[model samples]
Target: MLLPRTFEALPELPKGKQIQVDFGELKVKNSEGKTVKLYVIVFVLSHSRYKYTEWQEHPFTTRDVLRCHENAMEYYGGMTEEYVYDQDKLMTVSENGGDIIFTDEFQAYKQDRGFRVYLCRKADPESKGKVENAVKFVKYNFGKNRVFHNIESWNEQCLAWLKRKGNYQVHNTIKKRPIEVFALEKPHLREVSAPLSFESNLGSSITRIYCN
Candidate 1:
Protein backbone atom coordinates (compact mmCIF):
# COMPACT_ATOMS: atom_id res chain seq x y z
CA MET A 1 0.00 0.00 0.00
CA LEU A 2 1.16 3.55 -0.71
CA LEU A 3 2.15 5.53 2.37
CA PRO A 4 -0.07 8.36 3.52
CA ARG A 5 1.27 11.89 3.10
CA THR A 6 1.32 13.87 6.32
CA PHE A 7 2.72 17.36 5.77
CA GLU A 8 0.48 20.30 6.58
CA ALA A 9 -0.78 22.69 3.96
CA LEU A 10 1.33 25.83 3.75
CA PRO A 11 -0.36 28.87 5.19
CA GLU A 12 -0.73 31.97 3.05
CA LEU A 13 1.21 35.02 4.01
CA PRO A 14 -0.70 37.76 5.79
CA LYS A 15 0.45 40.68 3.68
CA GLY A 16 1.18 39.05 0.34
CA LYS A 17 4.79 38.41 1.22
CA GLN A 18 6.58 35.09 1.28
CA ILE A 19 9.80 33.48 0.16
CA GLN A 20 10.78 29.98 -0.90
CA VAL A 21 14.11 28.13 -1.09
CA ASP A 22 15.02 24.80 -2.63
CA PHE A 23 17.89 22.82 -4.12
CA GLY A 24 18.21 21.26 -7.56
CA GLU A 25 20.77 19.44 -9.68
CA LEU A 26 21.26 19.38 -13.45
CA LYS A 27 23.40 17.27 -15.78
CA VAL A 28 25.50 18.71 -18.56
CA LYS A 29 28.60 17.87 -20.63
CA ASN A 30 31.93 19.64 -20.24
CA SER A 31 34.28 21.11 -22.83
CA GLU A 32 36.17 17.82 -23.12
CA GLY A 33 32.88 16.04 -23.95
CA LYS A 34 32.33 14.35 -20.62
CA THR A 35 29.20 14.12 -18.45
CA VAL A 36 28.94 16.41 -15.45
CA LYS A 37 26.52 17.42 -12.72
CA LEU A 38 25.73 20.90 -11.44
CA TYR A 39 24.09 21.61 -8.12
CA VAL A 40 22.17 24.87 -7.85
CA ILE A 41 20.18 25.80 -4.81
CA VAL A 42 18.02 28.88 -5.30
CA PHE A 43 15.91 31.28 -3.22
CA VAL A 44 12.94 33.34 -4.43
CA LEU A 45 10.96 35.93 -2.53
CA SER A 46 7.33 35.20 -3.41
CA HIS A 47 5.69 38.60 -3.69
CA SER A 48 8.57 40.25 -5.46
CA ARG A 49 10.00 37.19 -7.16
CA TYR A 50 13.46 38.52 -6.33
CA LYS A 51 15.74 35.56 -6.85
CA TYR A 52 19.20 34.26 -5.95
CA THR A 53 21.01 31.18 -7.23
CA GLU A 54 24.19 29.37 -6.15
CA TRP A 55 25.96 26.57 -7.96
CA GLN A 56 28.36 23.95 -6.61
CA GLU A 57 29.57 20.45 -7.52
CA HIS A 58 28.91 18.43 -4.37
CA PRO A 59 26.11 16.87 -2.39
CA PHE A 60 25.46 19.57 0.18
CA THR A 61 24.94 18.58 3.79
CA THR A 62 22.66 20.63 6.01
CA ARG A 63 25.39 23.12 6.93
CA ASP A 64 26.32 23.69 3.33
CA VAL A 65 22.67 24.29 2.47
CA LEU A 66 22.21 26.90 5.21
CA ARG A 67 25.29 28.72 4.03
CA CYS A 68 23.67 28.93 0.63
CA HIS A 69 20.69 30.65 2.25
CA GLU A 70 22.97 33.03 4.09
CA ASN A 71 24.58 33.97 0.82
CA ALA A 72 21.15 34.44 -0.75
CA MET A 73 19.99 36.55 2.18
CA GLU A 74 23.08 38.65 1.83
CA TYR A 75 22.23 39.02 -1.81
CA TYR A 76 18.67 40.00 -0.95
CA GLY A 77 19.87 42.14 1.96
CA GLY A 78 17.61 40.44 4.50
CA MET A 79 16.15 37.12 5.60
CA THR A 80 12.58 35.99 5.27
CA GLU A 81 10.73 34.87 8.34
CA GLU A 82 9.78 31.57 6.69
CA TYR A 83 11.07 29.25 4.00
CA VAL A 84 9.29 26.46 2.13
CA TYR A 85 11.29 23.36 1.29
CA ASP A 86 11.00 19.73 0.33
CA GLN A 87 11.55 16.83 2.68
CA ASP A 88 15.22 16.38 1.90
CA LYS A 89 17.12 13.96 4.09
CA LEU A 90 19.47 16.77 5.03
CA MET A 91 16.62 18.72 6.56
CA THR A 92 14.32 16.25 8.25
CA VAL A 93 15.00 13.31 10.55
CA SER A 94 11.61 11.64 10.58
CA GLU A 95 7.88 12.10 10.07
CA ASN A 96 5.63 10.25 12.49
CA GLY A 97 1.88 10.86 12.09
CA GLY A 98 1.67 14.64 11.53
CA ASP A 99 4.84 15.44 13.44
CA ILE A 100 8.13 16.20 11.71
CA ILE A 101 11.46 15.73 13.45
CA PHE A 102 13.97 18.04 11.83
CA THR A 103 17.55 16.87 11.67
CA ASP A 104 19.88 18.28 14.29
CA GLU A 105 21.86 20.20 11.72
CA PHE A 106 18.76 21.58 10.04
CA GLN A 107 17.13 22.53 13.33
CA ALA A 108 20.24 24.29 14.52
CA TYR A 109 20.44 26.13 11.24
CA LYS A 110 16.85 27.32 11.58
CA GLN A 111 17.34 28.38 15.20
CA ASP A 112 20.43 30.36 14.35
CA ARG A 113 18.77 32.06 11.42
CA GLY A 114 15.36 32.50 13.09
CA PHE A 115 12.82 31.23 10.59
CA ARG A 116 10.16 28.61 10.31
CA VAL A 117 10.92 25.67 8.01
CA TYR A 118 7.95 24.17 6.19
CA LEU A 119 8.42 20.81 4.55
CA CYS A 120 6.53 19.41 1.61
CA ARG A 121 5.00 16.07 2.38
CA LYS A 122 6.23 12.89 0.75
CA ALA A 123 4.73 12.66 -2.74
CA ASP A 124 3.34 16.17 -2.40
CA PRO A 125 5.45 18.32 -4.66
CA GLU A 126 2.84 21.04 -4.94
CA SER A 127 3.43 22.24 -1.40
CA LYS A 128 6.50 24.05 -2.65
CA GLY A 129 5.36 24.70 -6.18
CA LYS A 130 7.00 28.10 -6.53
CA VAL A 131 10.45 26.69 -5.84
CA GLU A 132 9.78 23.62 -7.95
CA ASN A 133 8.76 25.87 -10.82
CA ALA A 134 11.77 28.08 -10.30
CA VAL A 135 14.03 25.01 -10.43
CA LYS A 136 12.60 23.97 -13.78
CA PHE A 137 12.83 27.54 -15.02
CA VAL A 138 16.51 27.68 -14.16
CA LYS A 139 17.23 24.33 -15.77
CA TYR A 140 15.52 24.84 -19.10
CA ASN A 141 15.89 28.61 -19.39
CA PHE A 142 19.28 29.19 -17.80
CA GLY A 143 20.95 25.80 -18.10
CA LYS A 144 19.98 24.84 -21.65
CA ASN A 145 19.54 28.30 -23.13
CA ARG A 146 23.17 28.77 -24.09
CA VAL A 147 26.55 27.08 -24.33
CA PHE A 148 29.33 28.18 -22.02
CA HIS A 149 33.04 28.37 -22.70
CA ASN A 150 33.58 27.45 -19.04
CA ILE A 151 31.34 26.54 -16.10
CA GLU A 152 32.49 29.49 -14.06
CA SER A 153 31.93 31.85 -16.94
CA TRP A 154 28.58 30.25 -17.63
CA ASN A 155 27.60 30.78 -14.00
CA GLU A 156 28.60 34.43 -14.16
CA GLN A 157 26.54 34.85 -17.29
CA CYS A 158 23.69 33.02 -15.62
CA LEU A 159 23.76 35.40 -12.67
CA ALA A 160 23.71 38.37 -14.97
CA TRP A 161 20.81 37.02 -16.97
CA LEU A 162 19.01 35.91 -13.83
CA LYS A 163 18.99 39.46 -12.60
CA ARG A 164 17.96 40.94 -15.91
CA LYS A 165 15.54 38.30 -17.09
CA GLY A 166 14.28 36.55 -13.96
CA ASN A 167 14.44 39.23 -11.31
CA TYR A 168 13.32 42.10 -13.47
CA GLN A 169 10.45 40.33 -15.14
CA VAL A 170 6.87 40.69 -13.94
CA HIS A 171 5.70 37.63 -12.06
CA ASN A 172 2.37 36.08 -12.94
CA THR A 173 1.76 35.24 -9.29
CA ILE A 174 2.10 38.74 -7.81
CA LYS A 175 1.49 40.80 -10.96
CA LYS A 176 4.31 43.10 -9.86
CA ARG A 177 7.78 43.14 -11.36
CA PRO A 178 10.48 41.64 -9.17
CA ILE A 179 12.53 44.78 -9.22
CA GLU A 180 9.52 46.79 -8.22
CA VAL A 181 8.73 44.46 -5.36
CA PHE A 182 12.35 44.44 -4.35
CA ALA A 183 12.24 48.20 -4.03
CA LEU A 184 9.42 47.83 -1.54
CA GLU A 185 11.09 44.96 0.29
CA LYS A 186 14.32 46.85 0.64
CA PRO A 187 12.94 49.20 3.25
CA HIS A 188 11.77 46.32 5.43
CA LEU A 189 14.96 44.26 5.27
CA ARG A 190 17.23 44.07 8.27
CA GLU A 191 20.56 45.82 8.12
CA VAL A 192 23.40 43.76 6.74
CA SER A 193 26.08 42.80 9.26
CA ALA A 194 28.61 43.07 6.47
CA PRO A 195 28.78 43.85 2.83
CA LEU A 196 28.02 41.08 0.35
CA SER A 197 31.10 39.17 -0.83
CA PHE A 198 31.81 35.76 -2.24
CA GLU A 199 32.15 33.06 0.37
CA SER A 200 35.38 31.04 0.11
CA ASN A 201 34.14 27.77 1.59
CA LEU A 202 31.54 27.34 -1.16
CA GLY A 203 34.28 26.23 -3.50
CA SER A 204 35.20 23.21 -1.35
CA SER A 205 31.62 22.11 -0.91
CA ILE A 206 31.11 20.94 -4.50
CA THR A 207 32.67 18.47 -6.93
CA ARG A 208 32.82 19.09 -10.68
CA ILE A 209 31.03 16.64 -12.90
CA TYR A 210 31.18 17.86 -16.49
CA CYS A 211 29.32 16.73 -19.56
CA ASN A 212 30.67 17.19 -23.03
Candidate 2:
Protein backbone atom coordinates (compact mmCIF):
# COMPACT_ATOMS: atom_id res chain seq x y z
CA MET A 1 0.00 0.00 0.00
CA LEU A 2 1.98 2.91 -1.33
CA LEU A 3 -0.81 5.28 -0.39
CA PRO A 4 -0.11 8.94 0.14
CA ARG A 5 0.17 11.18 3.28
CA THR A 6 1.03 8.37 5.68
CA PHE A 7 4.53 8.31 4.17
CA GLU A 8 4.90 12.02 3.44
CA ALA A 9 7.53 12.27 6.15
CA LEU A 10 9.89 10.31 3.97
CA PRO A 11 10.55 11.88 0.57
CA GLU A 12 9.49 8.62 -0.98
CA LEU A 13 9.53 5.01 0.02
CA PRO A 14 12.77 3.34 -0.95
CA LYS A 15 12.92 0.19 -3.04
CA GLY A 16 13.06 -1.83 0.18
CA LYS A 17 10.01 -0.17 1.64
CA GLN A 18 7.37 -2.75 2.45
CA ILE A 19 7.03 -6.44 3.18
CA GLN A 20 3.53 -7.79 2.71
CA VAL A 21 2.43 -10.31 5.34
CA ASP A 22 -0.32 -12.87 5.12
CA PHE A 23 -1.53 -16.11 6.74
CA GLY A 24 -2.36 -19.41 5.08
CA GLU A 25 -2.84 -23.06 5.89
CA LEU A 26 -2.37 -26.41 4.17
CA LYS A 27 -3.79 -29.87 4.83
CA VAL A 28 -1.55 -32.88 4.36
CA LYS A 29 -1.10 -36.41 5.60
CA ASN A 30 1.39 -37.32 8.29
CA SER A 31 3.26 -40.64 8.40
CA GLU A 32 0.30 -42.23 10.17
CA GLY A 33 -1.92 -41.38 7.13
CA LYS A 34 -3.95 -39.01 9.28
CA THR A 35 -4.60 -35.56 7.86
CA VAL A 36 -3.25 -32.55 9.72
CA LYS A 37 -3.19 -28.82 9.14
CA LEU A 38 -0.11 -26.65 9.03
CA TYR A 39 -0.43 -22.92 9.45
CA VAL A 40 1.94 -20.53 7.75
CA ILE A 41 3.05 -16.97 7.67
CA VAL A 42 4.16 -15.92 4.17
CA PHE A 43 6.25 -12.80 3.75
CA VAL A 44 7.09 -11.20 0.41
CA LEU A 45 9.33 -8.22 -0.13
CA SER A 46 7.33 -5.93 -2.37
CA HIS A 47 10.38 -4.67 -4.19
CA SER A 48 12.13 -7.94 -4.81
CA ARG A 49 9.45 -10.56 -4.42
CA TYR A 50 11.94 -12.33 -2.18
CA LYS A 51 10.00 -14.50 0.24
CA TYR A 52 10.37 -16.22 3.60
CA THR A 53 7.74 -18.58 4.94
CA GLU A 54 7.36 -20.12 8.41
CA TRP A 55 5.07 -23.00 9.33
CA GLN A 56 3.54 -24.38 12.51
CA GLU A 57 1.47 -27.47 13.23
CA HIS A 58 -1.10 -25.42 15.16
CA PRO A 59 -2.69 -22.12 14.37
CA PHE A 60 -0.50 -19.08 14.84
CA THR A 61 -0.89 -16.84 17.90
CA THR A 62 0.39 -13.34 18.61
CA ARG A 63 3.69 -14.57 19.99
CA ASP A 64 4.24 -16.79 16.99
CA VAL A 65 3.56 -13.86 14.71
CA LEU A 66 6.07 -11.69 16.58
CA ARG A 67 8.75 -14.33 16.50
CA CYS A 68 8.15 -15.01 12.81
CA HIS A 69 8.56 -11.32 12.11
CA GLU A 70 12.00 -11.53 13.64
CA ASN A 71 12.86 -14.56 11.55
CA ALA A 72 11.57 -12.90 8.37
CA MET A 73 13.66 -9.79 9.00
CA GLU A 74 16.69 -11.92 9.70
CA TYR A 75 16.10 -13.85 6.47
CA TYR A 76 16.03 -10.59 4.57
CA GLY A 77 19.09 -9.43 6.46
CA GLY A 78 17.16 -6.33 7.60
CA MET A 79 13.76 -4.77 8.10
CA THR A 80 11.86 -2.53 5.74
CA GLU A 81 10.59 0.97 6.45
CA GLU A 82 6.99 -0.23 6.64
CA TYR A 83 4.91 -3.39 6.61
CA VAL A 84 1.75 -3.97 4.60
CA TYR A 85 -1.04 -6.07 6.07
CA ASP A 86 -4.72 -6.83 5.84
CA GLN A 87 -7.07 -6.60 8.82
CA ASP A 88 -5.50 -9.48 10.68
CA LYS A 89 -6.91 -10.00 14.18
CA LEU A 90 -3.53 -11.13 15.44
CA MET A 91 -2.39 -7.52 15.47
CA THR A 92 -5.54 -5.43 15.46
CA VAL A 93 -8.29 -5.36 18.03
CA SER A 94 -10.66 -3.58 15.71
CA GLU A 95 -10.82 -1.59 12.48
CA ASN A 96 -14.09 0.10 13.25
CA GLY A 97 -14.37 3.11 10.97
CA GLY A 98 -10.61 2.97 10.54
CA ASP A 99 -9.80 3.87 14.16
CA ILE A 100 -7.31 0.98 13.93
CA ILE A 101 -6.77 -0.10 17.50
CA PHE A 102 -3.92 -2.59 17.54
CA THR A 103 -3.47 -5.42 20.00
CA ASP A 104 -1.56 -4.18 23.04
CA GLU A 105 1.38 -6.48 22.41
CA PHE A 106 1.61 -5.66 18.70
CA GLN A 107 1.31 -1.95 19.41
CA ALA A 108 4.29 -2.18 21.72
CA TYR A 109 6.30 -4.16 19.18
CA LYS A 110 5.52 -1.68 16.40
CA GLN A 111 6.57 1.27 18.54
CA ASP A 112 9.75 -0.41 19.69
CA ARG A 113 10.78 -1.15 16.10
CA GLY A 114 9.97 2.42 14.97
CA PHE A 115 8.66 1.23 11.60
CA ARG A 116 5.45 2.17 9.84
CA VAL A 117 2.42 0.05 8.92
CA TYR A 118 -0.10 0.13 6.10
CA LEU A 119 -3.32 -1.66 6.83
CA CYS A 120 -5.24 -2.65 3.73
CA ARG A 121 -8.99 -2.67 3.60
CA LYS A 122 -10.75 -5.83 4.71
CA ALA A 123 -11.23 -8.44 1.94
CA ASP A 124 -9.21 -6.38 -0.50
CA PRO A 125 -6.73 -8.44 -2.52
CA GLU A 126 -5.12 -5.92 -4.86
CA SER A 127 -3.20 -4.10 -2.19
CA LYS A 128 -1.48 -7.16 -0.82
CA GLY A 129 -1.61 -9.65 -3.67
CA LYS A 130 2.06 -10.51 -3.67
CA VAL A 131 1.90 -12.24 -0.34
CA GLU A 132 -1.51 -13.71 -1.05
CA ASN A 133 -0.07 -15.38 -4.12
CA ALA A 134 2.87 -16.49 -2.06
CA VAL A 135 0.53 -18.26 0.32
CA LYS A 136 -1.04 -20.09 -2.58
CA PHE A 137 2.35 -20.89 -4.04
CA VAL A 138 3.34 -22.56 -0.81
CA LYS A 139 0.15 -24.59 -0.79
CA TYR A 140 0.12 -25.78 -4.38
CA ASN A 141 3.77 -25.90 -5.30
CA PHE A 142 5.15 -27.24 -2.03
CA GLY A 143 2.50 -28.50 0.31
CA LYS A 144 0.00 -29.99 -2.11
CA ASN A 145 0.38 -33.77 -2.43
CA ARG A 146 3.49 -33.56 -0.27
CA VAL A 147 4.06 -35.77 2.73
CA PHE A 148 4.38 -34.14 6.14
CA HIS A 149 6.72 -36.29 8.15
CA ASN A 150 7.00 -33.78 10.98
CA ILE A 151 7.33 -30.05 11.54
CA GLU A 152 11.09 -30.18 11.12
CA SER A 153 10.96 -32.11 7.84
CA TRP A 154 8.21 -29.94 6.36
CA ASN A 155 10.23 -26.79 7.11
CA GLU A 156 13.45 -28.26 5.81
CA GLN A 157 11.68 -29.23 2.61
CA CYS A 158 10.21 -25.76 2.28
CA LEU A 159 13.65 -24.19 2.80
CA ALA A 160 15.21 -26.32 0.12
CA TRP A 161 12.29 -25.65 -2.19
CA LEU A 162 12.66 -21.94 -1.60
CA LYS A 163 16.34 -22.05 -2.42
CA ARG A 164 15.82 -24.30 -5.43
CA LYS A 165 12.76 -22.72 -7.04
CA GLY A 166 10.64 -20.39 -4.92
CA ASN A 167 13.05 -17.47 -4.73
CA TYR A 168 15.40 -18.54 -7.49
CA GLN A 169 12.93 -18.79 -10.34
CA VAL A 170 12.17 -15.59 -12.21
CA HIS A 171 8.87 -14.11 -11.16
CA ASN A 172 6.28 -13.42 -13.81
CA THR A 173 5.87 -9.75 -12.95
CA ILE A 174 9.42 -8.92 -11.95
CA LYS A 175 11.26 -10.54 -14.87
CA LYS A 176 14.09 -11.37 -12.50
CA ARG A 177 14.74 -13.81 -9.72
CA PRO A 178 13.80 -12.43 -6.31
CA ILE A 179 17.24 -13.08 -4.91
CA GLU A 180 18.84 -11.08 -7.69
CA VAL A 181 16.59 -8.10 -7.10
CA PHE A 182 16.93 -8.48 -3.36
CA ALA A 183 20.66 -7.97 -3.68
CA LEU A 184 19.99 -4.47 -4.93
CA GLU A 185 17.20 -3.82 -2.45
CA LYS A 186 18.94 -5.19 0.63
CA PRO A 187 21.35 -2.29 1.08
CA HIS A 188 18.49 0.18 1.35
CA LEU A 189 16.61 -1.78 3.96
CA ARG A 190 16.98 -0.89 7.63
CA GLU A 191 19.72 -2.79 9.42
CA VAL A 192 18.71 -5.83 11.42
CA SER A 193 18.75 -5.26 15.15
CA ALA A 194 18.90 -7.51 18.19
CA PRO A 195 15.79 -9.62 18.66
CA LEU A 196 12.98 -8.24 20.77
CA SER A 197 12.12 -10.10 23.99
CA PHE A 198 8.57 -11.05 23.00
CA GLU A 199 7.44 -14.28 24.66
CA SER A 200 4.35 -16.41 24.39
CA ASN A 201 1.35 -15.98 26.64
CA LEU A 202 -0.08 -18.96 24.79
CA GLY A 203 0.94 -22.35 26.17
CA SER A 204 2.45 -23.75 22.96
CA SER A 205 5.78 -23.08 21.22
CA ILE A 206 7.16 -23.52 17.71
CA THR A 207 9.73 -26.30 17.42
CA ARG A 208 11.69 -25.18 14.36
CA ILE A 209 12.05 -22.08 12.19
CA TYR A 210 13.61 -21.87 8.69
CA CYS A 211 15.14 -18.42 9.09
CA ASN A 212 17.33 -17.39 12.00
Candidate 3:
Protein backbone atom coordinates (compact mmCIF):
# COMPACT_ATOMS: atom_id res chain seq x y z
CA MET A 1 0.00 0.00 0.00
CA LEU A 2 1.17 3.48 -0.85
CA LEU A 3 1.11 6.15 1.82
CA PRO A 4 -0.29 9.59 1.07
CA ARG A 5 2.36 12.21 0.55
CA THR A 6 2.30 15.35 2.67
CA PHE A 7 2.51 18.79 1.17
CA GLU A 8 4.31 21.82 2.49
CA ALA A 9 2.37 24.55 4.30
CA LEU A 10 1.08 27.35 2.13
CA PRO A 11 3.17 30.51 2.31
CA GLU A 12 1.78 33.89 3.19
CA LEU A 13 0.43 35.53 0.03
CA PRO A 14 1.37 39.04 -0.91
CA LYS A 15 -1.18 41.79 -0.52
CA GLY A 16 -3.57 42.02 -3.48
CA LYS A 17 -1.78 39.13 -5.09
CA GLN A 18 -4.49 36.50 -4.87
CA ILE A 19 -8.22 36.20 -4.37
CA GLN A 20 -10.42 33.13 -4.03
CA VAL A 21 -13.98 32.87 -5.28
CA ASP A 22 -16.83 30.56 -4.35
CA PHE A 23 -20.61 30.31 -4.30
CA GLY A 24 -23.16 29.05 -1.80
CA GLU A 25 -26.92 28.62 -1.64
CA LEU A 26 -29.19 29.76 1.16
CA LYS A 27 -32.89 29.15 1.72
CA VAL A 28 -34.84 32.06 3.13
CA LYS A 29 -38.31 33.59 3.19
CA ASN A 30 -39.05 36.30 0.67
CA SER A 31 -41.27 39.36 0.97
CA GLU A 32 -44.35 37.18 0.51
CA GLY A 33 -43.16 34.96 3.37
CA LYS A 34 -42.48 32.13 0.95
CA THR A 35 -39.30 30.17 1.25
CA VAL A 36 -36.92 30.65 -1.67
CA LYS A 37 -33.42 29.68 -2.54
CA LEU A 38 -30.73 32.31 -3.17
CA TYR A 39 -27.21 32.00 -4.53
CA VAL A 40 -24.38 34.05 -3.07
CA ILE A 41 -21.04 34.68 -4.73
CA VAL A 42 -18.10 35.34 -2.42
CA PHE A 43 -14.60 36.64 -3.04
CA VAL A 44 -11.86 36.61 -0.40
CA LEU A 45 -8.47 38.24 -0.52
CA SER A 46 -5.84 35.63 0.32
CA HIS A 47 -3.55 37.84 2.39
CA SER A 48 -5.91 39.99 4.42
CA ARG A 49 -9.00 37.74 4.65
CA TYR A 50 -11.05 40.59 3.24
CA LYS A 51 -14.24 39.37 1.54
CA TYR A 52 -17.07 40.60 -0.67
CA THR A 53 -20.42 38.95 -1.35
CA GLU A 54 -23.37 39.36 -3.73
CA TRP A 55 -26.69 37.55 -3.81
CA GLN A 56 -28.66 36.25 -6.75
CA GLU A 57 -32.18 34.86 -6.69
CA HIS A 58 -31.30 32.10 -9.18
CA PRO A 59 -28.31 29.93 -9.96
CA PHE A 60 -25.47 31.76 -11.70
CA THR A 61 -24.46 31.40 -15.32
CA THR A 62 -21.17 32.43 -16.90
CA ARG A 63 -22.46 35.93 -17.45
CA ASP A 64 -23.50 36.19 -13.85
CA VAL A 65 -20.07 35.06 -12.75
CA LEU A 66 -18.41 37.73 -14.88
CA ARG A 67 -20.72 40.40 -13.51
CA CYS A 68 -20.15 39.31 -9.92
CA HIS A 69 -16.39 39.29 -10.46
CA GLU A 70 -16.48 42.83 -11.78
CA ASN A 71 -18.61 43.93 -8.88
CA ALA A 72 -16.34 42.28 -6.37
CA MET A 73 -13.29 43.97 -7.87
CA GLU A 74 -15.07 47.29 -7.76
CA TYR A 75 -16.04 46.71 -4.16
CA TYR A 76 -12.41 46.04 -3.33
CA GLY A 77 -11.50 49.12 -5.40
CA GLY A 78 -9.13 47.02 -7.54
CA MET A 79 -8.28 43.56 -8.85
CA THR A 80 -5.72 40.98 -7.89
CA GLU A 81 -3.03 39.25 -9.92
CA GLU A 82 -4.57 35.80 -9.49
CA TYR A 83 -8.01 34.31 -8.82
CA VAL A 84 -8.60 30.88 -7.33
CA TYR A 85 -11.71 28.82 -7.89
CA ASP A 86 -13.11 25.35 -7.43
CA GLN A 87 -14.21 23.23 -10.36
CA ASP A 88 -17.28 25.36 -10.83
CA LYS A 89 -19.17 24.80 -14.09
CA LEU A 90 -19.70 28.47 -14.78
CA MET A 91 -15.98 28.99 -15.06
CA THR A 92 -14.53 25.56 -15.74
CA VAL A 93 -15.61 23.15 -18.42
CA SER A 94 -13.16 20.31 -17.84
CA GLU A 95 -9.81 19.26 -16.44
CA ASN A 96 -7.80 17.44 -19.06
CA GLY A 97 -4.57 15.88 -17.79
CA GLY A 98 -4.21 18.46 -15.02
CA ASP A 99 -4.94 21.37 -17.37
CA ILE A 100 -8.20 23.18 -16.71
CA ILE A 101 -10.41 24.07 -19.63
CA PHE A 102 -12.41 27.14 -18.77
CA THR A 103 -15.75 27.94 -20.30
CA ASP A 104 -15.64 30.22 -23.34
CA GLU A 105 -17.24 33.11 -21.54
CA PHE A 106 -14.86 32.82 -18.63
CA GLN A 107 -11.91 32.53 -20.96
CA ALA A 108 -12.96 35.67 -22.74
CA TYR A 109 -13.41 37.47 -19.47
CA LYS A 110 -10.03 36.32 -18.24
CA GLN A 111 -8.38 37.47 -21.41
CA ASP A 112 -10.01 40.85 -21.09
CA ARG A 113 -9.22 41.19 -17.38
CA GLY A 114 -5.64 39.79 -17.58
CA PHE A 115 -5.46 37.69 -14.44
CA ARG A 116 -4.23 34.16 -13.80
CA VAL A 117 -6.74 31.44 -12.87
CA TYR A 118 -6.06 28.75 -10.32
CA LEU A 119 -8.41 25.81 -9.85
CA CYS A 120 -8.24 23.72 -6.73
CA ARG A 121 -7.70 20.05 -7.28
CA LYS A 122 -10.65 17.72 -6.87
CA ALA A 123 -11.60 16.97 -3.23
CA ASP A 124 -9.05 19.56 -2.05
CA PRO A 125 -11.35 21.98 -0.25
CA GLU A 126 -8.54 23.01 2.05
CA SER A 127 -6.72 24.59 -0.84
CA LYS A 128 -9.32 27.33 -0.86
CA GLY A 129 -10.15 27.32 2.83
CA LYS A 130 -10.32 31.10 3.16
CA VAL A 131 -13.23 31.55 0.77
CA GLU A 132 -14.86 28.37 2.01
CA ASN A 133 -14.81 29.74 5.54
CA ALA A 134 -16.19 33.02 4.24
CA VAL A 135 -19.16 31.18 2.75
CA LYS A 136 -19.77 29.31 5.98
CA PHE A 137 -19.43 32.50 8.00
CA VAL A 138 -22.03 34.25 5.87
CA LYS A 139 -24.43 31.34 6.16
CA TYR A 140 -24.11 30.94 9.89
CA ASN A 141 -23.43 34.49 11.06
CA PHE A 142 -25.38 36.54 8.51
CA GLY A 143 -28.12 34.18 7.41
CA LYS A 144 -28.94 32.30 10.57
CA ASN A 145 -32.28 33.17 12.17
CA ARG A 146 -32.58 36.19 9.91
CA VAL A 147 -35.87 37.44 8.54
CA PHE A 148 -35.38 38.74 5.01
CA HIS A 149 -38.14 40.85 3.48
CA ASN A 150 -36.94 40.39 -0.09
CA ILE A 151 -33.84 39.92 -2.18
CA GLU A 152 -33.25 43.66 -2.32
CA SER A 153 -33.76 44.07 1.41
CA TRP A 154 -31.57 41.10 2.17
CA ASN A 155 -28.77 42.61 0.08
CA GLU A 156 -29.22 46.01 1.70
CA GLN A 157 -29.04 44.48 5.15
CA CYS A 158 -26.10 42.35 4.12
CA LEU A 159 -24.09 45.42 3.09
CA ALA A 160 -24.92 47.11 6.40
CA TRP A 161 -23.94 43.98 8.29
CA LEU A 162 -20.70 43.73 6.34
CA LYS A 163 -19.80 47.28 7.32
CA ARG A 164 -20.80 46.91 10.97
CA LYS A 165 -19.78 43.31 11.62
CA GLY A 166 -18.13 41.31 8.86
CA ASN A 167 -15.46 43.75 7.74
CA TYR A 168 -14.97 45.44 11.08
CA GLN A 169 -14.92 42.38 13.31
CA VAL A 170 -11.59 40.78 14.15
CA HIS A 171 -10.98 37.54 12.29
CA ASN A 172 -10.28 34.51 14.43
CA THR A 173 -7.18 33.37 12.56
CA ILE A 174 -5.79 36.73 11.38
CA LYS A 175 -6.58 38.47 14.70
CA LYS A 176 -7.29 41.71 12.83
CA ARG A 177 -10.22 43.51 11.30
CA PRO A 178 -10.53 42.77 7.57
CA ILE A 179 -11.27 46.36 6.73
CA GLU A 180 -8.10 47.54 8.42
CA VAL A 181 -5.99 45.01 6.56
CA PHE A 182 -7.81 45.83 3.36
CA ALA A 183 -6.80 49.45 3.71
CA LEU A 184 -3.19 48.35 3.64
CA GLU A 185 -3.73 45.98 0.75
CA LYS A 186 -5.62 48.47 -1.41
CA PRO A 187 -2.47 50.20 -2.65
CA HIS A 188 -0.98 46.95 -3.92
CA LEU A 189 -4.04 46.01 -5.96
CA ARG A 190 -4.23 46.55 -9.71
CA GLU A 191 -6.25 49.53 -10.87
CA VAL A 192 -9.21 49.33 -13.23
CA SER A 193 -9.64 51.95 -15.94
CA ALA A 194 -13.31 51.42 -16.69
CA PRO A 195 -16.19 49.14 -15.87
CA LEU A 196 -16.36 45.66 -17.39
CA SER A 197 -18.75 44.92 -20.18
CA PHE A 198 -21.45 42.25 -20.14
CA GLU A 199 -22.01 40.37 -23.35
CA SER A 200 -25.24 38.97 -24.76
CA ASN A 201 -25.27 36.13 -27.26
CA LEU A 202 -27.72 36.54 -30.09
CA GLY A 203 -27.48 33.79 -32.70
CA SER A 204 -23.79 33.95 -33.70
CA SER A 205 -22.06 37.18 -32.80
CA ILE A 206 -22.02 38.62 -29.28
CA THR A 207 -23.03 42.11 -28.24
CA ARG A 208 -21.26 43.69 -25.32
CA ILE A 209 -22.65 46.44 -23.11
CA TYR A 210 -20.88 48.26 -20.29
CA CYS A 211 -22.32 47.93 -16.81
CA ASN A 212 -21.80 49.91 -13.67
Which candidate number maximizes TM-score? 3
List model 2 lDDT by residue over 1-212, tens digit each: 78321111223235888888999988899888999999989998888888999999999878889888988888888999889888788999997675899987788778877789899875667778777788888788989989889898889899899999999999877699988988999998898767754564554332232346
- lDDT for model 1, on a 0 to 1 scale? 0.69
Model 2 collision count: 0
Better by lDDT, candidate 3 or 2:
3
TM-score of 2: 0.86
Instruction: Kindly provide the TM-score of model 3 when superposed on the true structure, using C-alpha atoms.
Output: 0.89
**Residue 212 CA error for candidate 3 (Å)?**
13
The weakest ten consecutive residues by lDDT in model 1 span 203-212
| Two-way TM-score contest, 1 vs 3, winner | 3
Q: What's the TM-score of each model vs. the native?
A: 0.77, 0.86, 0.89
In terms of TM-score, how similar is model 1 to the real structure?
A: 0.77
- Model 3 lDDT per residue over 1-212, tens place: 99543321367699989998989999977657778888999898988888888987889988888888888888999999999998888888888998888888788888878999888864787678888888888877998778777778888888888899988899887889999999999999999757765655553222444556
- Candidate 2 Cα outliers beyond 4 Å, as residue runs: 1-14, 200-212
- Give the poorly placed runs of model 3, Cα more than 4 Å off: 1-9, 199-212
Model 1 misplaced stretches (Cα beyond 4 Å): 1-17, 148-151, 190-212
